[model samples]
Target: MAGAINATDASKRYAVVTGGNKGIGFEICRQLACDGVTVILTARNEHKGTEAVEKLRGLGLSDHVLFHRVDVTDASTLSSLVHFVNTNFGRLDILVNNAGVIGLVANESALKTPEERLLNMMGAISHNYELSAECIEINYYGSKRMTEAFLPLLQQSKSPRIVYVTSGWSKLENIPNEWAKGVLNNVESPPEKLDEVVNKFLEDLKNGSSKEKEWPSRMSAYVVSKAAMNAHARITAHKYPSLQVNCVDPGYVKTDINFNTGKITANEGAQNIVRVALQPEDGPSGLFFDCNKIVAF
Candidate 1:
């Protein structure tokens, strides 16, 4: 067997954050790098990614910060991330699956008053079949893909941790569909089963029966996707006893997803995620956190 690692050795640890160009993702990368962990800040656009890294460097975080391009929706781009990490770092200690979408379009032109726009932005959203499908593809499947790709490297570390950036919307009570809630709430539920629920949600929208089927009428897809992401975090923790796989619901923060109407700042929202990602060797796994405290999934 390979020798065990010294959990206290911070210099050897490394992390990769998806969608790190802006908002919460960017803050996570900045904070992690500040803590001495070599961080790869990934973004879909190369120029934006480099700029984000440069901003970090300007703050004297140049020693361990780097940039990479990754579009969670593209398979080849994801594979490239895996290869880059493997070839450069050889192993990974933390993986933050932060890339996600709100799954709804804003009709800014239709609204007259800023209050009306802010109200619409802060409130629930309506989604279509295509929007929901893509939301699931990225928010849920994209996280899954990134996790699977980095699992080997994570296993090599003594204190491997996976943090899923979920939301309070992931709570079962928010999802009106009892069947979907039951599947996700079951701690032993597998990924295949979660996929089944998500697929059915898209099908419901296609059949024009989303309301009749009991999906959340507003932000249905986004809610379902986060719920599924939470479930996957539980499943992964169960499947990997050697690793600490946890999900965190970073409370509503002012970011692009919520159109800057949130109560907290991105840095405030990222603190909990960073906490989960840097959990100790014996930290709790298979758990969900509403920021810093462990809560039900």
Candidate 2:
């Protein structure tokens, strides 16, 4: 197994982190760059992306960092990212899908809370803010599109890894049995079917009918989206045996996503992600992780 590469050897490695302008993504970029990898910190906003690059530059890591304006939901922008990577690096060693959203009420709603749910309901409530204009478009579909666009570049590398930053909120045990069965049943099911499920979820949320008893109890769009992402990672790993693809929940790090009320620091949250990203060729693939341990899908 190839041990972790030092900064001097990092120039030979290339990595990209989506939504890397701030939070765990930003820290991941810093850690990766510190190890000498040429890291691309991508964000939807060009100004923010550039500013993030400058922050790293201030720390004397500018030589190892680059900024790209990328919104995962925008197909054109994603294509451009692929082109940029291909033109500049020729191959990609790591791709981190760190961008995501929480679109549901994280409150202590009598309707949603379980008898003994372990997560902090108050913390979840505090973190559950309003959705963005493109939260759904970017959170689930955006990550999927990114994987599709970058798969080719990743294939070119001698050893490639894709890490999907997921969440504990996405546990399948919380999903409705019917919907969960439909998605987790077979890998051969059409991809469009997954989209349909998500669409139905949104429709239910919009129509106020999601409160029905049949609906998944913890059916936050964000949770389902991350679950779908994890499922997609499994499918992708099965499809491409050469690539190492896994999903992880970086245990509640304090970031803008949670309004900075998390228990873990951004650096601590990013460690597991970086560990998976830098795994050797024989590392586990198509697995889901909570913190560092592999979790059941």
Candidate 3:
């Protein structure tokens, strides 16, 4: 069994939040530190990342928060994060995979007001092949890299938890591709199978047969990448029952991902993600939580 676990011992806990410079990710970092957990708030941009740490310091969370620059898509950056965690904290208690991309382009100047954009979330953006690939690489593969790299450090903890901040688009029904849905549905499927499903979507996208292939017509890359993340979450849980691993939809929060067009505040969204992240040792694993309730994949 895991060490006699206690969630309230925040001072003894250490956590890492990816893309933590702003938005929901920043909120996640703040709340975790408020819980007394030491948090590493990582961002791709060094200046922005350090500035965020300073902001937390202003909040008097300076003792609980620090900064690191990590582009999840880059293995070396992740390696550096791994080394820092290993050498200092010696273990990892929680990891929040909150980084993501909208997989589309939009002219914010031309965009309607946030209220209007909220009403037309799907219609507000446009997609192309390059952004499509980048989304998959970062959203899906990036999380995979983080998990694999941190496994050793995580194992050093008495209780390790991973929270995959997926999306409502991750719902299988949102993906029109039935075959790809089946792969995600297969709890017995390996990580390679998830990789295959994502690759298929990319191929269809490049050939312009994505629609004909029944892939998600809108937010194609975002939808597919998140679904893949959800699948890996399930696999990780199954493979390591001693750990708490789960996926969550943090709600549609107004952040940069949506051009600050979402309806909910970042705090509201981070609340749900944090709740799932701080689950106790014996808590359920390999499940998808929407609004803090377990829901279908």
lDDT of 3: 0.86
lDDT of 3 by residue, 1-297 (tens): 011222334249999999999999999999999998888999999988888888988999977888889999999999998988887778899999998886776545655676555435465333588988999999999999999998888888898999999998889998877789888888789789999998998888888788778888777798899999999888899998888999999888888777686779999999999998887767899999997889999
Off by over 4 Å in 2: 1-11, 104-133
TM-score of each: 0.92, 0.85, 0.92
Q: lDDT winner among the candidates? A: 3
Taking the tens digit of each residue's C-alpha lDDT, what string does model 2 give over 233-260?
A: 8888888999999998899898867667
**lDDT, candidates in the order shown:** 0.85, 0.77, 0.86
TM match of model 1 to true structure:
0.92
Residue 95, candidate 3: alpha-carbon lDDT: 92
User: Clash number for every model?
Assistant: 0, 2, 0
Better of 2 and 3 by TM-score: 3
The residue-by-residue lDDT of candidate 1 on 1-297, one tens digit each, is: 101222434357888899999999999999899888988899988989999988988999877788778988898988887887777777889999999998876668788755567566436444656877999999999998888888998998878999999988878888889999999988798678998999999998898888888988767888899999888888888889999998898888888787677789999999989988887788999888998877776
Worst 10 residues of 1 by lDDT: 1-10
Any idea what lDDT model 1 has? 0.85
Better of 2 and 3 by lDDT: 3
